[model samples]
Every structure is written in C-alpha cells, then in structure tokens.
Target: MAGEPAVTPVPTDDELVVVPLRHWWRWVGGAVILVLLGLLGWALADAKIDYAAVPGFFTHDIMLRGLVNTVVLAVVAQAGAIVLGVVIALMRRSANPVARWFAAGYVWLFRGLPVLLQILLWFNLALVFEDISFFGIWEEKTNVLVTAFVAALLGLGLNESAYMAEIVRAGLNSVDHGQVEAAKAIGMTPATALRRVVLPQAMRVIIPPTGNNFINMLKGTSMASVIGFLELIHAANNIASRNLQIMETLLAAAAWYMVVVSVASVGQHYLERYYGKGVAR
Candidate 1:
C-alpha cells in the first residue's frame, strides 16, 4: 500500500448526529404517556376526595374578601419595595461612605431577620407604645386592622426591598463602563448619565427579577394572614373552620393562588421576552 494521509470520518447528509431521534412520533408518544399518568393519579385521588365539601366552603364572602386583601397587600408592598429598592440601590452606589453604610446596614438587618418576626414586631408596635404621636400631627388612635395592614406592608416591603436592592445594584453594575465614559465625555452630569444611559440598559436585567419578586410577593401576602390581615389564607381558614372541611377550603384557596400565580407568570414571561429583545439585537 502507498503511504497516504488517514481519512477523517464525515457524516453523509442522510445521517443523524445531535438529537439523533428526531421523530415527531417520539414527542407525541411521551406527551400521551404523561397525560395518561396524570389522569390516572387524579382519578385515584378524586375517588377518596369530597368534591361537595370543597364547593360549599369556596362560596363564602370572607373568602372573597381575603382574595381581594391578598391582591391589595401584594400591590402595596411591591410598590413600596420598588421605591425603597431604588433608593437603597442609589445609596449603596453613592460616593459618600455614610450613605453606603446606612444602605448596607439596612439591607443586612432586614435580610438577616425572619419575615414572620418582622410582621409580628410590627403587629405589636401598639403594645410597645400605645399612644405615640408622630410630629404632633394626627393623634388618632391606631386600630388593630389598620395597624396590622401597615405592619404587614412595612415588614414585607422593607425586607423585599433589600433583595431587590441587590438585584438592581447588580444590574446597574453590569452596564458597560464604556457607556459611562462616553456619557461623561459628552459633558453629561453624573445623575443625567446614570438616568439616561445606565438605568435604561440595566432595566433589561432588573425587570425580570423585579417581576419574579412581585410574583413571590403575591404568595408572600399569605404571610400577612399571620398578623391578622385576613388575606386569602386567613379567609380560607375562617371558611374551613365554619364548614368543618378544612382540607377542602384549603384546596380552594390553593386553587385560587394557582390561578393568580399563573396569570402573573404569563405576564412576566411576556415582559421578560420584551426586555430580552433589547439585548438580543
């Protein structure tokens, strides 16, 4: 045989390589199997379940109010979180050491403590000082319900803000240094540069995490019930207590939560895709 270079193997056009099993039937078969398994499990679970009990408990007015309360709490708390998060992020990145330390310490303290404990502490603020007046303005006595709502909002919002602050800071930091230099070279003020050039780019990073936090905040609103805010879970608790079908009422509550979360998830996905387009091109 003559001396010759060894030939390297190459695949023909008809040959499959990556994901070799590209048959459409495979995916359809797998999907069908999964559906069959799910149906079987549901049928088995339903046989022992009391569907009638679930319906009776789900029809209560308090349960309806609880759902509304959950929505309110989530909206309020997330609004507070966004505002505080932005402020804390700005403070963290400030040139002043005092501002930076204050922001860091605030985040450190809240992030370190349990959310439940914070809620409880706020709930008991009246016990700490039953009649404390702020700036001698309105000296009206605080009602338990109002106090509890405020407490829950404060606890949830402030704690959530710390995490959001970190997310925002990271996003801002991710912006290209060259952009900042360009802004400065163009005689833009530091604040103007940050507002115009940096924050807009950072929004691509920030929005997804912020939306996720909002969704989580919706679930976290359930924690407000612990402080007597009568959110969705609390309403479910009351309904279950009256109906003697705690499990069923709880399931109804869970179902509602699933619906709410699902809607939020869809919205988040769309927003994420929208923001992602900025980076893709």
Candidate 2:
C-alpha cells in the first residue's frame, strides 16, 4: 500500500467548458437609445415647418457675401491673434519684470472683460477719443478710422490674443529648457534660437489648440452681427425679417455654418496629423 502510485483525476472536455458572459444591459441600453433617436426624428419630421425655403435661402447672394465676410474676418483676426499671441507669450517668458507684468496685465484685462463689451467699445471708440494721432505726422478721426469691420477685427483679435498668449506660452513651455540652452551653446541669438530651434518643437503642441481656437473664432464671428458687420447671422436675420420666414432662414444659415465648420474640421485633422508625425501616440 505504501508503494502504490496515487491516482490523479483528469478533467473531461465538458468540465473545462467556458460560458460566455452575457451583457444584456448593454443590448437594452442600445435599443433604448435607438428608440429615442427615432422618436426625435419623427417629431421633427411631423413639425409644421417650411422645409422648402431652407434650400432656396441657403445659396442666396446675401448669404454668400456674408459667408465670405465671416471667412475673411476669422482668417485675418486669427492671423493677427497668432502674431500678437507669440509676442505676448515671449513677453510672459521674458526676464524683464516690466515685460512680464505688462503681458500678465494684458491677458488679465482682455480675458476678464466680456468680448461683446469690447466689440461695442471699439465700435463706439469715437465717444472716448475724437481722433488718433501718429507722432504729429498722421491723424484721423476715430469714427473714420474705426469702421464696423475694423472694430470687429480689433475686438476679436485682441480678445483672442489673450487666450492665444496663454496657449503659446504653454507650447513654449513644453519645449525642454535644455533645447534653448543648446541653441545658446551653439551661439544662436535668443530670437534665432526661438525661431530655428524652439518654435519648431513648440508648433507640435501649438497647432491643435490653435486649430480649435480658429474654429471657435469662425463661429464667434456671429457675435459681430450686433455691431452691424453683416456676417452670416446678420445676413440671415435680414432675410428672415423681410420675408417673415425666421426659422427657415435661420436654419439655412445654420446649414452653411455646419458646412464651413465641417470643412475646417477636416483641414484641422490633417494639419494635426502632419505636425503629430514622429511623436509616439
């Protein structure tokens, strides 16, 4: 009995069976979501609205002009913002106390104020100052110089610069301090190092948020309507008022906004991918 081998019971195929887990709740949740979407779609379809008018107004000459104005304003304002943002960002990082304080105050003031108020103030700048003078060489009436478009641009651009300054500063900060040191070690000037060594690396971090900001700026151009800049929303409002078809006109404008935003989003995706290359995901 002491020398006998111990018997080991081997598991049969049936004993090793695996029962797959059932996610019944997931199925139920998905069905519920589908049902809700269907209900919403049906309600929208049954609503009494002039669907035909949307198409006609979608491509109206006024709408097209407004679209152009919106695109132009957004592009130009963003360009100005990027330039100002870089300068302010550099100022924020400057060793000079005055530059740092000025940059901080600029960010705080603009970011604190409501952008609409800024726009209105710019539009009505004539109330505060009659004319703008340049070193006793050139002068112009405030009202003459600050047209509706100029007011909108300044308001949007300057306000955006406050945000972009922070963004650029963050991007600049993302670069390793050693990179700047290395550039200096190679006898590069501060400006040259920033342009040649630092900015290239910072761009990888900067491009994504900058793209989002541009899209936001595009939509934000709607706010310019209050100052009579004749952007997409204002153009739509005019048409709506004349025809007494408010919803249809507004919907058409919304469609155009969607189209533009979609195109911009695609572009942004490619730009991001381009810059994101060489970085591990």
Candidate 3:
C-alpha cells in the first residue's frame, strides 16, 4: 500500500460519449447548392457569353489607368478617413463639452448628407471659401480646388469619417471600464491609458466592421466617376464607348471589383483572426 500509485477511474460509455442528432435540411441544402453550381458552370461555359474578351480587358490604357486611379483613391481616402475617424471618436468620447458637441455635429452633418451631393458640394466648394484672409490687409485664393481627384477624395474621405467615427467610438466603448480604472490606479495619464490599454483591447471589436467599411469604400470609389474622376467603372465606360464592347468592358470591371473585394475579404479574415488573439488574452 505504501509503494502503490493512485489511479483515476475511466468513465463508462454513457458518460464518455456524446452523439449529435441528424438534420435532414443540411443534406437537402448541400444537394441544392451542388445542383445550382453545376447549372451555373454549364451556363457560363456555353457559347453565348464571350469569355475570350476578358484577356483584352487589361490591354487598353484606359482600363489600366482607371484601375490604378481606383486603387490610389481607395487607399488614400481610407487612410485619411481612418485617421480622422480616430480623432473624431476620441473627441466624441471626451469629457469636454465643446469637443463632444463639435464631434457630434460633424458626424450628424456628414452622415445626414447623401454621398453624391457631398461629392458635388466639395466639387463646387470653391464658390464659397475661395479666398483666405487673416485680416483685411492680405488675402490669397484658397487652395481647395474641386478637381476630379480632389473632389472624390474629400467627398469619400469625409463621408467615410462619420461612419468610421461611430465604429471607432463603439469599439472604444466596448472596452472594459475596469481596465481604465486599473490603468489610472497605476498612475497612467488618460492619453496613455487609452493608447496602452483601451485602444489595443478595442481593436478586436473594431477590425471586422472596419474591414466591411473598407470594402464598401472600394465600391463607393466607383461613384467618383459621376464627377469625372476616372476610376475603374469610368474607365470601362470609356473603353466600352470606344470599342462598342459595352457588356464585355463592364463585365471586366465587375470582375476586377469582385477580385479586389475578395482579396480584401481574405485580408480582413486574417486581421480579425489576429485581433481575435488579443481579445482572447
């Protein structure tokens, strides 16, 4: 008895094993999806659609340039929107009444306006703030020209900021209040507590929605074409007009958009997963 080691007893079959119940709808759904996919593939490969024209889609200079411009617009606008959103979110959350009011007003004003009207407004904004003068002594023309590119950037970025502000504020608020208290207990300043404690924890909740916004912004960039900002859709329109292959050109643009969105989705998946780790911690 002194030399013997203790051993735990194993559970019986009823205690150890658990079985799932069968669901008939899952099988039906799988079969339906497979049948639909088969039909789709067959229809696409049929001679009615000219899949051959796809290769020529990128050969034209207009489409290429439009794609480049779209990429540049999306990247620049999203970056600017994200930075502005963070500042606005912080202001919205600030204890200072003035900061809170200004932030709230900004979000309300921008979010209330339609994006198209906003684009047109910024495009024609030069009519109002055309001149800059500190006093009556000296004056210079303001540099906010509503060029096609500038109009699209300002419209998209500013509009995006309002939405991003809400997203960021939601994320910030989702962080545990106790963490802030703990940070303060350790003598961390408000700014330091936010940066070191709140924001990092908040990112997990922030990333997924932010990714959805980015994807929407990518699509929104196409709206820039209305103001003569030659992004992918506009490029396709130009090429379609010139070549008379309207369907093909538009289809090509659609394909490209899908591809870009798909890639963004993949990136978002990884980002959510990465931040998911932090949330777990």
Worst 10 residues of 3 by lDDT: 138-147
- Candidate 3 lDDT, tens digit per residue, 32-90? 99999999999778746567887698556888898889888998999999999999999
- With a 3 Å backbone cut-off (N, CA, C), the pairs that clash in candidate 1 are none
Q: How many backbone collisions does model 2 have?
A: 0
What are the TM-scores, per candidate, against the unseen true structure?
Answer: 0.83, 0.93, 0.84
lDDT of 1 by residue, 1-281 (tens): 57988888888878856666679998999999999999999986877567777666666788778888888888899888888998999999999999999999999999899888888887787766666567898565555444778999989998999998999999999999999999999999999999999988898899888889898999998888886789889998887777577777888888788888898889888877886786676
Full-model lDDT, candidate 2: 0.93
Q: Evaluate model 3: give its lDDT.
A: 0.89
Task: For model 2, give the RMSD to the true fold.
Answer: 2.2
List runs of model 3 lying over 4 Å from the truth.
Answer: 1-24, 42-48, 127-144
lDDT of each: 0.86, 0.93, 0.89
Residue pairs clashing, model 2: none
Worst 10 residues of 1 by lDDT: 138-147
Candidate 2 lDDT, 165-259, residue by residue in tens: 99999999999999999999999999899999888889888998999999999999999999999999999999988998988898999998999
